[model samples]
Target: MSAARPARLAVGVVSAGRVGAVLGAALSAIGHRVVATAAVSKASLHRAETLLPGVPVLPPDEVALHADLVLLAVPDDVLPGMVRGLAAAGAFRPGQILVHTAGAHGISVLEPAVEHGVLPLALHPVLTFTGRSEDVQRLTGACIAVTAREDDEVAWSVGEALVLELSAEPVRVPEQARPLYHAALAHGANHLVTLVRDCAELLQREVLVATSTGSTDESMVGSASSTSAERVIGPLLSAALDNALRHGDRALTGPVARGDVGTLRTHLRELDRVDPELADIYRVLARRTAHRAVAGGLLPDHAAAEVRATLEEHR
Candidate 1:
């Protein structure tokens, strides 16, 4: 039997932060009434104004008093304190849904509110937020990592129903696995931006070198901000990501995969001059990639040995 959905919620966001504001708007879209939210910063206020519109900006406690579902989308570090403070303040009541969006935490972090007969849920959307209206639209087709009390079927059902209302899929994450789940997502998504941008900057430097030496590289026209270079690089990155996803470790390619010691040495020399930090990053990633390639049988044993030796020598 399908578990019964919770009452039609009156939502309250503790603060109209990036994730909070967009999610508040999403709930509003799904026929929930967002009565109030707390927003202090100018950015948060702006986001609330844009996303929540006519919803009143109230104090956290007042917002809590007005809503049946309290969305606590604060930073991970701030969440425990916030929940304790709100509970101490008598802001939570019996049967209130206390949902936090911090990926690193589960319902244990909301334990303080459980004393007030509140239902705790960890509803973490496994996607990035830009605090824009577009983020509301982005919620569709997204995966939400839902962590609920294992013994409470009603809590799990309510969490999944909320996710479905926002047009997202729900993946159950056990309370014990929240930290590891969050770490994996952060390692993949956050570091990916750093990796991609660094590669683009490195390519921009090479393009500058080509142009300064009097070469007519039409592709090198315009600033790094220009789509000219992105046009050349973006498709390559997309294809590489697609291949990596579909084939996993077997998608190995490039100088590291080929075990081109000379090419790697040249790259290290150039990058060392360009950015010492980048050179260090490149060396570490190349070594790891080479290891994966060998493990996947993409690189021969001899090639893997040579690559390892080259990396160790450079280090």
Candidate 2:
């Protein structure tokens, strides 16, 4: 394949999942044809229709047998067995490009397919996919982690070429580093969602208290203002996220960073009354935040010690 553009190969997506269908659409946009896909779930079938229209839905073996490039976008746990099963079924042929999107795995998991003389590559797009057209658009600036045999420059170039064709940058990741790379991404992206949702839930509770009328349930809060909590916090959260990305540890702020031990105690008591689990989570995160603040010079060691003491006393 050329560095500027990949050849228009016949592509087969092993399954029309959130990641698979959107990637298929990206490949198709760049002149490659999506020949076949396997989709069993209703959502998958709908995604195939929406993102990869005109592509035939076939069994996994048939999809692999018919394509020059096979994209295995299955879950991490399912990928190894699926590759082995396809190789055993004689579906993978010589000269076929076998690719997987599992972030934790490198080309090692493709060993079974490699035994069949197929060129194995791992191309994991770092962004989350929703099996939508917008997801294909998101690929334009997203980073894809490319892992091929360290000895094979041609294979590495091929993976890089494919990512470039989608207008995305490719970062070369060594096989041994794949697990840690994926873990870091998960810790940032996945945990960020959980953290944001927890914050939103807490804000919603306060919204309920501030806006209650004759009724005091959550429905009353919704009736008063459906998006009041989100409206109040969205811009602040967005700015904090942007600042954190741009400034790293220097972006630390709020009561924990200031070592407001009295404020921390009040928060813990309120959270403990409302939800013990949430209180525990807040305590743990606040303790860590205080440490980071101190290390970043936002808080003095004496202040951080006081914050930690307050958290432990609350526990």
Candidate 3:
């Protein structure tokens, strides 16, 4: 028999942190009833109060008892224990759906709830939450990754409906691949912040050096230079990202893509003279770029070999 149309269910949110509160509020705004939430911290409680005004803030067990769908928005480390605790407490009713916002975990963590007739799903929004009502609006048009061990038809429809209700796109990912997918996201987005911060510090040092040299550092000139840098860098980076997304590795540019040995050598020499630490990063990235370009048909095997040899020699 086809599963009953997944009801417009009442949702219970556990852990009223940024993701929990924002999602609860967004679902509520989209006409789902957020019946209860568990706010563990003072900050979380305040966030819940702000985002889910008039919604009862209950303990985890109480939330599970009151709602048909439960969202475990707790930290990844705490999720297994929390799920076990709920199961032991007889919190989930038969046929209830339980989900978590954890990207790194799949449905296995919810195994404790499975015997209780609870359907488990992993629904991770790709966008970051700002712990503000504005995030509810921002969630629209975002992308969410979903994985479930339940019937594919039911799981996919439920996930798609929820994402559509939130005005976001739903990408179905395999359960076993979720961790690796999450790792890729973390590596690109999270680590990039550290990289940018380092770049900003280097730029500030450059500014200080220019000022210290008593160069004709007019404020207008500095402002113009900063504006030009922003304009050029922003579009260049955007174009690079667009090309990567559209054409994959084939759209790579610069000396590495061209397999210019002299240019690679000059880059290493410049980095060594200015910042030896960055030289290693440059070399590694350049070598990878060359490999990708070669694979993408942008560079011949011999050219790639020459570039790789140049980088390895410098290293």
Candidate 4:
């Protein structure tokens, strides 16, 4: 029955990539037997050795053949071909549980394996992974996007149950919405990394320049400035993120939100002088932020017009 927890499954991970290795370990933690994993490349092999000690590393087809639950954790583009290739190889069996970790795909991509009568489900963990042991702990309280056939309640339950077994919350995503869902996550999480890194690099450059006047060795200065930059920005970025989450656009602050055109001009000039590309990025994002500030009623029409004019001047 759908309400029942999955019986202990012989789990087979198709590859020990970051997502695969971590999810395999999570399933193992929940008492599933990780019979084997397919890991190629030095990194993947090392990940398997570290995260899944004693598990046999085999080829993809062999791994699938050895398990009752086969996890396909390959890239989104590789997923369809892998599924079809495995199915053609007769690696999937009837009544087997076939799951993929590709966020952009739903059960549809598993159709080839489904033709073999496997129970197809898409269980995409919403967390980024580093293929490390700590990732297993991060699974707790994380959201996993679960997608099953619209009419298949049993499949839905199975997907959610698997997420629960990993100590994660399951959020149902309609098959049609997977692409947009994945895009939204990528836009936020991936772009946030770029944004944070840019900020850190700029801060580090400034710190290095300021500290260079001292007798400190160049390498030592660089190292110290990098750490100092992180220390300076960490709490500020954390609070900004927390406030944005809690207060929505009302959390908007700083020059853009205040519609301080003079301050905006200064930022544009500084960035353009030091990092022209970053200045271009700032202009684009500041334009968007200004729009949001106005929508949030934080900026008046006159002030927003001035801000827009200043940005255009910098462009």
Candidate 5:
């Protein structure tokens, strides 16, 4: 695409799912002309109407035909086929900007369209889409990671403009880094769900056992009853995350980070006694933390050596 003049960009959104509808609406609300969308589900159609008001629900090909910018918010696995189909159907107009919102993928999936002279880009918001109206609120003040082909400056500018219109910060990430970035996000948010569920089940079992024994203290019951899992974990995690983000890797403060080898050994012994399967997890995490501490210059060479030795012995 030519980078001379900023085009009066007309936007078309394909796959009117949660992310697509919310963003299409947000773009429309910001005075960008959202020309059309392709919504497959009734709920998606309802969301499209809510967001885009009277915008037409057109076919996928029509979306590409009408707009200068096209967004593909479909499932990740289906994206390549969709782009190839669009390209085969002559849907991509020359210089049209085609962007997808998949975090795990880079702009390479849009290679078919790129060959057709379409500028490929990616704009992934670092937030989950829960298909709730509140998602619109969540879109504001979010961080979106943008990835574009090195040669496509116009597409990059369009991605930045979209972020600005949404009141979100855009960070340019390299194409090869997309998968690792997405894996980090999934490890943090998705794995936390499994971890929290396991904790909740354990707590419930403990509570039931205590109740059956009729030895549960009133104060203990009250504390457990009044504080939810989220209440207990959210603030603590938020503070740790804040420290990690603002103060860098040196902000790590657990036993491993502090080179408290004896404390780590004690914890590993306890885990082996209570849950043998968890011992490996403890060892691995402690080793990782030790590496981080060493990298941050928080641990001396001797201390790092000791930490690694302890973790290896436990493993």
Candidate 6:
């Protein structure tokens, strides 16, 4: 049996937030009709106007009443109450497909709407959104994690069908594993941004110190120096990322990995002088990196211990 209920189904976005607005546009591109959506904040309203032109901005219940497929793209914490409220309001109709995009949850969160006879599904896009037209194209080749109700073969197929409609790959994730899956992605992607920004800040300090003598002071470092620092790190960082992804622990090549205790001491002192918090971050990450390198056989145990001691004593 085909998973999609019908061709050209009317789609309703509960709120045209960043993920919602762009996905509404994507569906519209692939023969689905975005009949209506709910938008409250000024940014959401602007996003709807830009991405979902001609689609009516209706209330959540009204949008639900009008569509065959109701997409609930609100935050994770609010979804449960929102579903219960809509079910209580008689918004869900029998045979309507209810899908949510929260990564942390699966079909369990949509159980309230099941009473209204809606087919529940959890379809999470593994990529971030910018609420722009470009995101529609970026959806191509991206992976979407789907968790459907157990024993509901039809719903699982429907979820995959929807992902295929968007030109993305679908990976089935068991309901129990959703939280761990979400955590891994967040730890890698979200924390990478914070780590990169910290590295750029450190590089900026070096650039500032080099371009100006000690008399100039840190306050005088401007955007030009910041840009220069980023430019200097950009390609190097890009190659390092590529190598790390392709070669794994074999890509470990630095003072810590090489057991250069003197170099590690220098880095600790420099980071401490720049910012105490950053020095702590460095110590923590370096310790983790050395452990992983040793485990992977990239560094001997003795080398790792020496690196650890240098990091521990960098007072």
| RMSD in order of candidates | 2.4, 2.6, 3.0, 2.5, 3.5, 3.1
Clashing pairs in 2: none
Q: In candidate 6, how many Å is residue 42 off?
A: 0.8
Misplaced by over 4 Å in model 3 are: 1-6, 150-152, 207-214, 217-232, 273-277
Q: Point out the higher-scoring one by lDDT: 3 or 4.
A: 4
Give the per-residue lDDT of model 5 (tens digit) for 1-315: 224334457999997898998888777766679899998789998888887778899999999899988999998888989999999999997878888998889999999898888878899999989766688888899999999877767667867877877888888988999999999999987876766664555444554445534546777666556656566566776788789889888788878888899998898887787667767766876787888898898888789899999888887
Clash count, predicted structure 5: 0
The 10-residue segment with the lowest total lDDT in model 1: 220-229
Tens digits of per-residue lDDT, candidate 1, 21-48, equal 9999999988889999999999999999
Q: Which residue pairs in candidate 3 have backbone atoms (N, alpha carbon, C) closer than 3 angstroms, thus clashing?
A: none
TM-score of 5: 0.82
lDDT of 6: 0.88
List of clashing residue pairs for candidate 5 = none
Weakest 10 consecutive residues of candidate 3 by summed lDDT: 224-233
Error of 5 at 222 (Å): 4.4
Give per-model TM-scores.
Answer: 0.93, 0.94, 0.87, 0.94, 0.82, 0.92
Task: Please tell me which model should have the higher lDDT, number 4 or number 6.
Answer: 4
Q: Quote the positional error of residue 147 for candidate 4 in Å.
A: 0.5
Count of clashing residue pairs in every prediction = 0, 0, 0, 0, 0, 0
Q: Which pairs in model 4 have colliding backbones?
A: none
| lDDT, each prediction | 0.89, 0.91, 0.83, 0.92, 0.82, 0.88
lDDT by residue for model 3 over 248-309, one digit each (tens)?
A: 98789999888789988997997787788888888878887888998899999999999989
Off by over 4 Å in 5: 1-8, 41-46, 187-223, 273-277
On a 0 to 100 scale, what is the lDDT of residue 67 in model 2?
A: 97
Per-residue lDDT value at 48 in model 6: 96
| Residue-level lDDT tens digits of model 2 in 1-315 | 675666789999989999999999999988999999999999999999999998999999999999999999999999999999999999998999999999999999999999889999999999988778999999998999999999999999999999988999999999999999999999999988988888878877765446655366768656776556667678988999999999987899988999888888889989999889989989889988987898888999998889999999989
Better of 2 and 6 by TM-score: 2
